[model samples]
Target: MSGSPPRRGSALAADRAEPRAVRTRERVVRALFDALAAAPLEELTVARLCRDAGVHRVTFYGHWPDIRTLAADVFAEEVDRLARVPEDVISEAAGPAELAAAYERALRDQLREILERRDVYRTLFASGSDAGFRRRLLAAQQERAEAAVTQLARAGAEVPGRASAYPAAFIAGGVVAAFEAWAVGGATGVEAAARAITAQLPGWWPR
Candidate 1:
């Protein structure tokens, strides 16, 4: 954990690039979700989704076992949307300061994303499409948590093997709560919550 991150472009590329398989997968997920907005998730059918995506039934079944699994996955992907910019926004970060600053920016971005995609979240959250709302939301939050871990780990913090996942989970829960308390009221405290959580990490911050 010393020199610059290994193949920054190559690594970052992996984050952005959607292989054909991934694109098809995401398209199917999105199609299913869009259909859910029109009706509840339970109403979605493989035949309808394939038609929406202009794909074939055989292809759909090749990728998904059943519509429920596909529905669960669609929700998972939707909730798990993440951005990878805050860490790069700041330059020579060190210790908690750097992490906190990036946290603030990222939190702000998250709110912006939520607000901008309000229609999407509202439809998804309101549709009560699937029984896996909480689970999918948790999964979504975990993606962000894991991204932060990668950033911090690259920054220099030695993540304790035993308690690694705990920090992210604790922090992500805090994030959602803050959004509920302040963001729900049309106020913005995302940055504040992010800073607070990042400060709680048990090691020096990374740049």
Candidate 2:
């Protein structure tokens, strides 16, 4: 933030190269996107991300606790955008099936967007072997899921449970599982994958 050179950590050496600290961060994130596209997450490392972003190690550490966290932040915009559908919007639809269909449509639109940019999510998710990495990804998803469920309840959708947390957890779990499997090279068909999870909504959530 301070144009002052980054502290001498591996996260930021490359960032110091640039006069502006903000510019340095952008460079690092850009490099990460580039690297993950070409390889798997197992191959990605903090050193590599710093080098690719053209920043120093200090710069990276300054910005993220780990590469996985950074990757999640990179993909955060898309996730936030997709999760923006008003919660109550579900009730406008006639029934659970209609609501499920509508929800899936919105979800699919975003899922496709993420899938289309498969390299980033794939690479970030590929790092799922690490608990911290998976937690970061899952936490971000859970936040969005919770908010969406609240919105749905406000709109009049009957989430089976009296509270939002249960349904929210169930929905987030299903979606995250599907995406996680795909990231790890699971054989499930995309349509089938989406439907498999979406189909559960009619029964799993409040009808």
Top-scoring candidate (TM-score): 2
Off by over 4 Å in 2: 1-23, 45-48, 72-81, 86-100, 113-131, 202-207
Instruction: State candidate 1's TM-score.
Output: 0.51
Assess every candidate by TM-score. 0.51, 0.66
Q: On a 0 to 100 scale, what is the lDDT of residue 143 in model 2?
A: 78
Each candidate's clash count: 3, 24
For residues 1-207, could you state the per-residue lDDT of candidate 1 as single tens digits? Answer: 778653321113233344765776777777875786687555677899999988887766656666765654554454355434443453466654576566566556666655544444444444353534445666567667776666667666676662568867765676655444433345345556556555654564443
Q: Which ten residues in a row have the lowest lDDT in candidate 2?
A: 6-15
